[model samples]
Structures are given as structure tokens and as C-alpha cells.
Target: MYINSSETAIIALLEKIKSLEEPDSAGIFYNAFIVILDAFVQPFSITILVSLVVLLVLLFFSAMVSGSEIGFFSLGPQHLEKLKQSTSGRGKLILKLLERPKRLLATILIANNFVNVAIVILSTFIASQWFNLSSFPVLAFIVQVVVITALILLLGEILPKMYASVYPVRFSKSMAGVLNVLIKMFYPLSSILVRSTSFLDNRVARKSHVLSRSELSD
Candidate 1:
């Protein structure tokens, strides 16, 4: 067996590369294990605790904004009459908000989306602090999809909307002040969205009318 100098050099290089990779691979596994261990053992930090509190607060606001959508929009003839007769400031605000339905809907949607995004970001931050979510795909999916979605659906969407629908007038009045401020604050965004939707509606109506006329002629 005759081996050349180049072959010897290649073998040495391969050996060195394998030696380097072995430690790196071990280090990665070791670090991941340590992270999993600490997730169970360590107490949450003050920052994490505070973020969790903020997350809960955001969820509360999410519930309020989501409820307001049903509350204001579900107001019936009777509900309007109540607001019309009431001397309360909130009733006045509710009436004012309803005066512009498109803008009101836009504001509610924008606020809901903004709060939901904040909830996700804060939740991710808290989870990352506690565990290496990237290392556990199943757990990550459960937390991000199942747990978070359930929380939003149950607390932020379903329950509030149910309550609002059942007591539209009361819910509308209770949420009116906050929504009044939000409508002003989000006016620019809501206005743009309202205009865009109106334009789309007009275009769709014209297209439908043209189709109907064509069908009649045929």
C-alpha cells in the first residue's frame, strides 16, 4: 500500500474536522438539556412576572374591545330608544359612535388586532424567558396555537360578545367612554379604512348592476 502526501494531508484534515464537530454537537445538546432542566427548576424573574401581568391586562382590554363590536352594532330600535331617552353621558357617546358605523367598526377591528398582536409578542417573550421553545416543537405549537388561541377565543371573543349581545345597551354604555377616546385616537386610520371599504362597495354594486342589465338584455 502506497499513500501519497496529498492523501495523508486530506486524512488529517478530515480527522481534525470531525474532532471539532464532535465537541460542538455535544455542546448544543448539553445546552438544550440545561435549558429544559432550568425551565422546571428556576423561579420566574420579576420582569417575567411583570410581563405576565401586562399580558393579562392586555387580554382584559382585548375582551373589552371585542365586546364593544357586538355591543354597539347590536343596538336595536329599543336600545336606541333607551339611549335617546337617557340623560347619561355614556348614552350620548354611544349614540355618537353609532352615527358613523363604518368608522366605528374600523376602530374596533384595528384596536382588536393591535391588542392581539401585543398579546402574542408578550406571550412569546415570557415563554422564551422560561423555556427554549425552539428546542421543543410540540410544546411550542401547543403554547402558541392551542393555549393562546383558546384564551383569545374564550376570554377575549366568545364570552364578551355573548354578554354584549344579551345586554347590548348596557354593554354599549359601559364601553362607550373608552371607545369614544379610541375613535378619536384612531380616527385617521379608521377614516382611511372606511373610505376604502366604501369605494370597494360602490365598485361591487356597479359591477353587479352591469351584470344584471346584461342578463336582462340577453
Candidate 2:
């Protein structure tokens, strides 16, 4: 019953992921992942309908996150060079964000993943029941995976990324404030992710994944 609720499902997944690093936990975690998806059908109810709406809203935000990263970070050497010459506040803010590439990367990663996971969980509840695909487990899983993948890639990733690439400055400016707020709001999760990745990268490469200022400028 709890698994049918979107909020519960997201929390469950987050809790599950937190254990992924533990020894011999992969099988347990994977089993829980498959077991979380269950029916969430109702004859008619405003409350139930609202949950589905929330998922759609999350999908939209996920798309924005995908696009914002491209728009914000796709600035080239020449673009950064020109921005450095400008004295505008927005340019200064952009430069400031670029200066902390790890935080920027971590913030986008956190927001994107958080939204995307919620979308998947919500979709699992609605898709299986709405389409009556529960009768065929293999087919249902395939269909759900395919549909979600297509929607996320087309609407949430490809379209937005293309638009961001085309109008980087406009999109980046529009997204800057929202991203700044998200970075702070999700800082706890972002910070942990950044730190863990840095630790692993240093072990593997003898350096962190974080880019240097000169590297960013180049």
C-alpha cells in the first residue's frame, strides 16, 4: 500500500540507494526495486488524480534541469572570454557559478536525479494499472521502460538540450536564479555526491573530477 503512494515510493528508493555501497547488498536492493511497483488504481478520486499530475510536473522540472545544465555550461572559450570582458551582473553571476564547477555539477545531478526518480516511481504506479499490463509482467516491464525512456529522452532531454544549445545565453540567464536556489536547497545531497565522486576520482585518477579555473576557461 505504501509503495503505491508516489511520495513513499521515492523515499523508499532513496533509502534503498543509500545502502548500495554496502557489501552484498546489491541483490537485496535490486529485489526491493522490482517489488516497489504495484497497482494504484481507483475508480474516481481527485486525490489520486493529483498524484499523477504531480508526476507530470516533476517530469517538466526534470526536463528543465537537463536543459539548464547544457545551457549554463555549454559556453565555449570564446563565449567565456567575451563574458569575462563584460561587467554585467548576470555575466558576473555566471562566472561565479562556473568558478565552482563541482557544486554546479552536483546541484544539477541532484535535482535531475531526484525529479527523474519520482517520475519513474509515479509512472510505475499509473502505467501498470491504467494499461492493465499487469497480466503480462515481461511485456509490462518492457513497455514501461521503453515509454519512460522515450518520453524522458525526447521531451526531458533531447528537446530541451537542443533548445539550450541554440539559445544558451537566454536559457542560462533564465535558469541561473532557479539553479542557485536549487543548489542551496539540495546542498546536503549534492555535497555528499560531490564529495564521494571526488574521493573515488582521486583514488582512480590521483586527481578529483572537479575542473580547475584555468581548465574551465580553456
**Quick one: best lDDT, which candidate?**
1
The reply for model 2, stretches above 4 Å from the true place, is 1-48, 81-89, 204-218
Looking at model 1, which ten-residue stretch has the lowest summed lDDT?
A: 33-42
lDDT of 2 by residue, 50-149 (tens): 8778877987898888998999889888778877898877777787888988899899988888788888888877775465454467878786788887
Candidate 1 local lDDT, 96-213, one digit each (tens): 8889999899999999999999998888778777655564578887887788889988999999999999988888888898988998999999999999999999999999999999
User: Which candidate tops TM-score?
Assistant: 1
Which runs in model 1 stand beyond 4 Å of their true positions? 1-41
lDDT of each: 0.83, 0.77
Q: What is the overall TM-score of model 1 with all chains considered together?
A: 0.79
User: What's the lDDT of the predicted structure labeled candidate 1?
Assistant: 0.83
